[model samples]
Target: MGYTIKDTRHLKNILRADFILGGLTAFTGLVFFRPLEGFLGLSQPFIILVPLANILYATAAFTLATAQRNPSIPLLRLLIGANWFWTLLSVALLYVHYTNVTTFGLTTLLFQIVIVGTLAYLEGNQLEKMA
Candidate 1:
């Protein structure tokens, strides 16, 4: 199947949204890690590393979103894979810390899982259409 221009636009939008959300997550984690550590009851390394990882992911997302032509299928596949990985990782973290995580922390993890998973699904669906 061939993709239309509209499909390209939709893919770009999804990538852009992922970039924006990831940037926000990174910024919030970096700026408020001290408080987040206490509130989330997670390790300091986890708090700091997540934001760093997000920074890289966001940069990749933005680059792909702004490509002059349609982004490559392989790259999009990798992005979708990363989104799924992050979603699953969040779920694992939630499970690991369920006993100690604050209500707010649990909520935060749930939101991350849902949002990232949704993005992964959207990206994957778009890719399937292109394929």
Candidate 2:
């Protein structure tokens, strides 16, 4: 098909990383309900948003991985932009205290933001290399 695996290795690897991270996030989100609600004392809506965010992350990861299979720069760029947007939203969430939260919840949220931001940064570098 005139395509070499080496040609897309960088993007493929980045996408794979995001995919794995998303999977882990979603899995953790499953148990997050109790801790987020009980320990953090989060409200119904915000707590529900946690799992929804995980779903979005999973969806984005799947789309990115699919895009990597064909290696479309524009599509990858759009997805990367969305990931950065998510990171920013996560940052905003840090300041907005719609409900109470424990140290664990706050720390977990911050760490997740850092993880996603780092992934986006790496992906950006890979995209630059692709160019």
Candidate 3:
């Protein structure tokens, strides 16, 4: 009889973290829409844009996680880049919002930093193991 080693605990943790981050990003993006709209007092098509931005960020995070799981997979690298891109964009947006005296921007910025920073750490660990 032959035994196989399939220790996927680390992978599972990565996936769980990614999922949580992705969900949070999506939620934040969605929640910000209403207040942003009221603050900006925008109407019609403009109001919808905020939610779309959130959805895009969520999509990027999802794709990034998929790529992390299979590093060797073609296009995974691109997805990873996209993930970081959106995260940084979100950070910048938060910074701007806070600078303009928007409430909770500080909290959002902190959460974004922690979540994205943790993802970066996990990604580094995965890459180290693969190497």
Candidate 4:
């Protein structure tokens, strides 16, 4: 089955929303990483990975929001790629316990994966529909 023009357009709008949501998720991850670790006893990776991911996400959020306002396919494609990579890495690392991560850490990681995976799913669907 094919998507109608309206459906495609709606999906594009949804992609923008998804991007905005992803940005929020990233920002949340950035801010909460430390607090969650110190107070909540959730062990996360070291400085580089945590901050870097959030920074990237924040940057992507701005880029995607701009793309949505500007209606740029290239920008959308870039965001789609970023989301795929981010989600894949997140899922891969979500369960790896070679290091010492607490139960809270594991549960939080799973929760984060769900949120990120949803965003990825939205982005993928939007991209496919746009095609």
Candidate 5:
């Protein structure tokens, strides 16, 4: 049986919401990474590396947001993987801090969960469309 692609016109709100959420995710990631040395007591090497990861995440969010509006390539697939990887890493860190979880850390962890969940849902819908 053949499948049909739904019109994106009806998804205007979703599209818009994704764009906004993606931007927020990117911005928050950048903000949270800035004071990593103070917040996480990271060494120089870790401070450098974590910021790089944040940069990559921000870039991926921007790419995903763009792809959501204009489906030209398989960028969303890359985004899905990147987002999942980052989310997993962040969750791991949160788990590490579970013994002495700070308010800031807990709040950031919750935000990451929300953003990852949203990205997962959007990516799944996009993949279904492709199939």
Candidate 6:
């Protein structure tokens, strides 16, 4: 079935929210990489690189959000998939680094996982509704 205008708007809003969040995360990570590295017991490259990727993700999200047509289902699925992937990776990272990760780092990672997982769930639910 075709999407309604309301559905498009809702999808756009969700993507826009993701864009803002990704931008913020990238900014914070880039700005505090050194401090984060020291506090999180994670490498500086990992800290720097993830934020760079976040910027790219934000860009894509912004583009998708501003699209003139109905939202692309494939792309939306990709975004949701990426979010889930990120959430899983974070959990794995937390497990791998459990020996060295500080409490602050653990909390930060957990927060990220929760946020991303929620976004994924929300996006997936919207997709199902659209379907």
In candidate 4, what residue range of length 10 has the lowest lDDT sum? 1-10
For model 3, residues 65-108, the per-residue Cα lDDT tens digits are 56534434233334445556656765776666655533454565
Between candidates 2 and 6, the TM-score winner: 6
Instruction: List residue ranges in candidate 4 displaced over 4 A.
Output: 1-20, 29-32, 39-48, 66-70, 128-131
Clashes of 2: 0
RMSD of each: 2.3, 4.6, 6.9, 4.5, 4.5, 2.5
Task: Name the best candidate (by lDDT).
Answer: 1
Tens digits of lDDT, candidate 1, 64-109: 8999998877677788899999999999999999998888888989
Q: In candidate 2, what are the lDDT values of residues 1-131, reduced to their tens digit?
A: 12223336666777778877777766765666666576665565776776677677667666767772566666667667877888888778877853456786677668868988988787776643322
Relative to the true structure, candidate 3 reaches a TM of 0.55
- Per TM-score, the best of the predicted structures is 1
TM-score of each: 0.90, 0.74, 0.55, 0.62, 0.59, 0.87
Model 1 TM-score, 2 decimals: 0.90
lDDT values for all models: 0.87, 0.69, 0.52, 0.58, 0.56, 0.83
Q: Model 4 TM-score? A: 0.62
Between candidates 2 and 3, which one is better according to lDDT? 2
Order the candidate numbers by TM-score, best to worst.
1, 6, 2, 4, 5, 3
- What lDDT, from 0 to 1, does candidate 3 have? 0.52
Task: Kindly give the stretch of ten consecutive residues in candidate 3 with the minimal lDDT sum.
Answer: 1-10
Cα-lDDT of candidate 1:
0.87
- Assess candidate 4 and give its lDDT: 0.58
